[model samples]
Target chain A: MENLIVEGSHGVYFVPYVNFNAETGECELAGESYLEDTVLFYNPLLEWLDNYINKKREAIKFNIKLTYFNTSSSRCLLDILNMLKDFEDEGGEVAVNWYYDEEDIDMQEEIEDYEIDTGLHINLIPSTDLVKHQEDDDDE
Target chain B: MEANNLEKKAQDTNKFDLFKYHSLFNQNVQISYKGPFDSKVLSVLGTYIQFTIGKNPKASKKIFNIFIELAQNIAHYSAEKNLFGVEEGVGSLVIAEYPEHYAFSTGNIVKNEDVIVIIEKIELINSLDREQLREYKRVQRNLPQREKGNANIGLIQVALTSANPLDIEVTLIDDKYSFFAITVKVDK
Candidate 1:
């Protein structure tokens, strides 16, 4: 399996950032997502996780840092989180982290809800730390 | 007879002005629009809401998120549509600024039969307090999304994001059609 990289867009419709590394088994989805066809956008990401779990069977670290997502996109997110929980259940090493704006009460509650719904220990980090790390990565 | 006709014309002009500037009654309305509701409309209004409301990013984002959900409801569920090749939701949206809160509202036409469902959804939302509303949203989120229309989670979202209870009103246009309006107020 090859790496899947999608640059997020902000236009007539918002698109979230997606970066899935086949070699390292590290995946990240960030930014806002409100697409014209949401299912079309998220299907491939779900497929990537399926391939990683069924084929690679390696340790996976998933990170989500979304500022806003519509209700439809939220469902797609639940699918991704549930897949991670399943992988964890199958003795696959999976770690999921969700970074949200500290000031955003709704996003914080949403992360908590995802944790409760999936029964996965999602590490909730503030966006400021995420940004700082990204800047450091760019510098390196 | 000429004087009577002049008086009638003057009265008509006054009525037109009153109708046109009805918003003047609440002069704090920061933004309002009446037209086809679509993705383009959301994008434009979303940007405006983000940038216009001072430096409070969280409040602006909340307003924007609430606006998107409500406006999308109109775009998807409104019985009235613009038939210019591709159909579009025909409705009106207004965002008013108060010292205590910002009120976002959308109104559109719906089939008389569908009004009951919408009212029930609003009533259910209004009944729940914040924590219950959150729980309700979680449960509904887990349910299967409808194949054709909204997953019926939009009102739940409005309830969660807004500072006050959801205000829903329906006016009968005729036996076949009715106008449905819902408002959400976000505190500053």
Candidate 2:
């Protein structure tokens, strides 16, 4: 399966970055998401997750690094997380990592909420160090 | 005693000068909508305000966010439901341009019993400085997620984006309902 990459207007669309890899079983979503059509944007992503989980052949690692999202987007996010939770319940190996800006207390809380909402252990990774690394990569 | 008298005279003179300046600054514009907030209208107006004010990108984003949040709040929660089939929520939204900044205000009828909770929430948000407000939002976000429509994150987002305290006033309309007005300013 090829990766899904769509460049969206940050702060306009609820999810700014999305990377779903079929071969690597790595999915990453980042940035601010406040999409006009929440259902339309999320449906395909949901289908991909469902396929990954149902196959039982792919080990998945999902990463979320969203700074801001509206309440509507939050509901849709919950839907996505619950799907992953169901997969975990079925004895699938899945790891979810959430990266937030160090100063963004709100983002930290959001990750916690997702953990509570999904019953999945989300690795709350602070982005300050990771951001510096990413910047160094860019320089290279 | 002499210093007090001199201060009084100075204040009176300053008030008179301010009144004269206010009379000279006569530029005012009022845009009002009564019905469901048409996204079409909002989009056009949002662009117009951005261009007219020549606001920075960040400020423009904040204004747009505030507009969308407040309009949605009215659409979803306003007690005065629109009778017309075209509009789902009935309320009045106004945006006025002042010399220094733009004032965005919204008013709608709310159930009397619900007024206290809304008022308290607004008051709590308004009283906090930026740091406290950020902490409060963090605390609220960490709580267990609700099934649906339960997170009050909208208010927090509005406050954060605008970088201005929320101004909320409530007036009793009747035994069952009250008029709630909320206003916030966005700098150019």
The number of the candidate with the highest DockQ is 1
Worst 10 residues of 2 chain B by lDDT: B17-26
lDDT of 2 by residue, B1-188 (tens): 69778669879887555555445433554566666655555555655554654445545555666776787677668888766564546677777777777788889899999998987888899899976876676566556654433246678767876778888889999899999998888776
Model 2 docking category: incorrect
The residue ranges of model 1 lying beyond 4 angstroms of the native Cα positions read A129-140, B1-25, B148-150
Residue B186 of model 1 has an lDDT of 84
RMSD, each candidate, Å? 4.7, 11.1
A1-140 in candidate 1: lDDT tens per residue? Answer: 99999887777787788899999999989888887888889999999889989999999999888878988899899999999899999899998888887878888888888888889999988866444222111111
What DockQ score does model 2 reach against the true complex? 0.11
lDDT of candidates 1 onward, in order = 0.83, 0.70
Estimate, for each residue in B1-188, the C-alpha lDDT of model 1 and write its tens digit: 69778669869886554454674546888888888887777778887998887466767888888888888878877898887754778899888888878888889999999989888888988998888988898899888887634455877887888757888889999999999888888888
